[model samples]
Target: MRSSMTLFSTRTLPLISAALFAFSFSASAQATVVDLGVANGYSAFIFGNIGSSGSSGFTSVGGSIAAGGNIYLDNYNVGTNKKPGSAVNSMVAGGNLNTGWGTLSGSAVYGVSNPNATLTAPQWFPTNNISKGNASTLDFAGAKQQLTTLSGDVAKLQSNGTVISQYGNMTLVGNVNADVNIFNIDASNLHNLTLDLSSLKSTASIIINGTATNITMSGGFDNFASFANRTLFNFANATTTSLQNVGINGSILAPNAAFSGSGDMNGTLIANSVSSINYGHVAMNGSGFNTVNVSAVPEPGTYAMLLAGLGVLAFMRRRTPARAPQAAMA
Candidate 1:
């Protein structure tokens, strides 16, 4: 009968290529997506070993931590207040920013506004305290805005514009480093990451973690201090977002909620190091030390070969035998 069905379709095409190579080697061992995005437009800069202790008022001018979206600036202490156009420093935070896109965990989530984030936009979003106003031009791209709708359909949206920054005055830890950015594509799961900076002249610490997942944090954005981010943690979202310099090792757990997805990487976003992160809380430029946690790289095993490629695809479909004889015997 047609040469025995052409010899059973050449032995079921080599058992369907060994069940798609054991389901692609168990999906490369599950959990794959750590690029922390970066490349096109380019961004990522880290420099540690910050000393010069502070307190009486604040001054540790040895910070150095940057990532970029375009690396805007309202203040970098250029001449004395990042001159040029002006927006030099101003904050009064707000909240609500969990639009789309997901997967982000490159760790760097310090602390600030935790007094229940009151006094309206207290510092500089989600949590990190702020409030260096008077300029009223600072804009971290409106913290990567996203409300959209306002005209009906989806009902009542509004927001509609912004890439990152709004209000202003932010510089996580200064003297220098604090220029974040995030927007790499291939779109897997990760949306906004508009971390604007330039004003911590008072207090603004943020040291989050990596190995990201569903996250959406937009804590009240004003800028000042309260001591928040020392608790709320959870990294594991197809990880990777490192500039290397893991201060504050494992067990990072503060950041109760945040999420966004649809990731790509063609945009590049490669520097790698999104793993170690502990509860937040730092004052650095404002004073508050204790940092540890160097470079670490683990999680290799390929998810047990993707669950052993599902029993090798059910033993190659039971050795592929019947195709029609009673529909393969039901």
Candidate 2:
């Protein structure tokens, strides 16, 4: 009986271990949703760090500005002053700033209120009434992690006449002549991808496979206005992504990536670091732009797997008999 019990223990232990392993893997593989928190209050600009060379450009940001690093606005105009909904928005910075001839219209500026902090424009929110650190209140790290997870999650990929090319660590999915937009990408499992939209009218929805990958966009997007309501770009797996002279239509989710661009983006920009140079402008979507609402519900498949594992463990425990008590002789 003792030998039989030992064998049973050994067999059951391995089965339990396997079940636990599967359960853990399923839980970890479950998708993660990022919460922007108060950072979403700003509709225009959000960045982990921002630096710029002094240049005069007619760049306009339609939403609020939140920065983890110092903001250097060199001859730039932020926020509309006349629009009824456009009350001077909020500007929250984790660090100090030197507004060099740039104007920001908002209720007030929040964050580190150093005495030496220069503010050329009038502030509705007094310096003495500074709020908490904007960067600390935000979960940039979690967002980046979500992106990394997304990179590991690939749904499906359909290619046309395009040839997948590799440039060092980067992967290019389309070419100039090929109608690269013919490829349908189900981002549910897409890891890292660099899509060339040099000759495409529209692109399919890209579900993010959150991973620590990088994505880049080259060329222009003419049909962006059509899909402005849908999510056009999702780089939840990328650490860094760049946009060069493209007109973006949908929401872009790159919570971990440092997004730098010189084009006009018409959507939500969520990232660890965001910067723009050479007349780059961000125009938020009126309906679903810069709202800090994220629901991280586990996928149905994940829930099913988890439940099945638990059920197996319960059955195994039921099958195992309890040790019987031995009677002592007087």
Top of the candidates by TM-score? 2
1-330 per-residue lDDT for model 2 (tens digits): 767756866787677768768776765565333333333344443445554435322255555565655565665555643233332334555555545555556544544433344443335423443344444444444544544454233212223324343442223243344322223332232323444445333533323232336666654443346545444355545677766656566556566677676666655566666656555744443323322212234556867876787787677668777879999988
lDDT of residue 138 for candidate 2: 46
1-330: candidate 1 lDDT, tens digit per residue = 756655655676466567757766554454222111111111111111111111011111112222111111111211122112212122111211111111111212211112232222223323232322221222222211210110011111111122332343222232223221111122222223223335322233333333344332222322222322211112324232221111221112211112111111111111111122231212112111112221221234544654565566566557656756554545
Q: lDDT for each of the candidates? A: 0.24, 0.49
Candidate with best lDDT? 2
Q: What TM-score do all the candidates reach, one by one?
A: 0.23, 0.51
Superposition-based RMSD of candidate 2 using all C-alpha atoms, in angstroms: 10.3
| 136: Cα error in model 1, Å | 15
Candidate 2 at 173: error in angstroms?
15
* Candidate 2 residue runs with Cα over 4 Å from true position: 1-36, 44-47, 53-58, 81-88, 113-213, 220-229, 276-330
lDDT of 2: 0.49
